[model samples]
Target: MSKYKLFLLRHGEGAWNKENRFCSWVDQKLSEDGVKEAQDCGRLLKEQGYKFDLVFTSILSRSIQTAWLVLEAMGQEWVPVVKSWRLNERHYGSLIGLNRAEMAQQHGEEKVKLWRRSYDITPPLIDESHPYFLEIYNDRRYTTCDVPIKDLPRAESLKEVLDRLLPYWNSTVVPEIRNGRTVLISAHGNSCRALLKYLEGISDEDIASVTLPTGIPVLLELDENLKPVKPRQLLGDQAKIQAAIKKVEDQGKAKPST
Candidate 1:
């Protein structure tokens, strides 16, 4: 057997996703179309005869549902799953619940574009006293190195997501790969980007430009040494994937609500 195959996927669409709101670390479930998309993704994997040895997902429902659907499609619904906050989406900070169009109207399209697209820049952090913050912090199912609310109540740059997520990859994910288990990761866009930056050895500036589409599985084959054995293989209709990513990159470009 090869070293191990890593199947990466960004979660399917969410309700808030359709509304053009920032969903970073927010617990939104998959939309109806999102569920169907996940099923289609699973069917694609099955058609390719792909099999998974282990599965992982962020603590959020959307990611969890995507993983479940993929595994079901692969006919490995019984596979063990590991859920971790380290796999959570990039924290969107102050933009979490705000409407994108309204924000653009208030903040101007140019400024909103910078907030949404700039790789290293972070939006304003959310207040610790905010209701969402308290709910997330108190949720027993969510785990972090420490109280995220106390230390990080705001948005995170892509760089920050990498710093936090990489350690888990090195310690948890690498060992599995070394042991020759194929791993499937169901996570967020920026989180997948974080892992890709590490696997592909892409630079910070370049990583900012990398975008992964929703519900599209990326196949990364590694050698015996856990190095990439092949260029990534992206599944699904290419046109649809491209459009979804464009939407993400254009998060704040839409006209604001009057």
Candidate 2:
């Protein structure tokens, strides 16, 4: 029996990520450090003799840009790439452009934590008056989505993100993997977490504390039955990966007073 490989990557830091803001669907590009992070991930994968047969990414620029950088580094720029909105970060809704630390300060760390980390708790819905509402809803990328514009989510819980992502995973991604192709999925933190929850059978409460560091590749070897052969492996420096995860966990905390 042959084993198939799958790689999941959370896109590198975005401009909004550096500012500790909720980027969700605002299409922010990767920051300077983010660019380097993507390149470094590619170099690491290259050093390990990995080559992808297919790539998938969210429509968000950060995710797409990370895919591009990684492919460029791997010298596999010609690989077929698929883009889907279902893989987008969980929509932050009214919190889209707001700073996470400031929100934590105003709403109390506990409440903000619920919004950010709870499986079923969703943030407030985005209203028409929000600054980026029109820009995001009217974007061309969304025009091609399977659902009508009005049907797109204004806010979503982690469960909702997984619900939306599963259709794409089952219909498109699974087929490719079963066909014996090596796959790479470049997506956002919440989206990747959603998929991980499904793949690993993690409990909802346990999934909340799982933080994926940006730009590192998560390697999984799947048996012919599509089950993991062993524990998933994260490629790159383990110490740095832990520190990056700590950074992600701290983003929702209130900044200490001067």
Whole-model Cα lDDT of every candidate shown, in order: 0.81, 0.93
What are the per-model numbers of colliding residue pairs? 4, 0
C-alpha RMSD values across all candidates: 2.4, 1.4
Best by TM-score: 2
lDDT of 2 by residue, 109-136 (tens): 9988899999999899999999999999
Q: How do all models score by TM-score?
A: 0.90, 0.97
Model 1 accuracy (lDDT, Cα): 0.81
Clashing pairs in 1: 93-154, 93-155, 101-256, 125-154
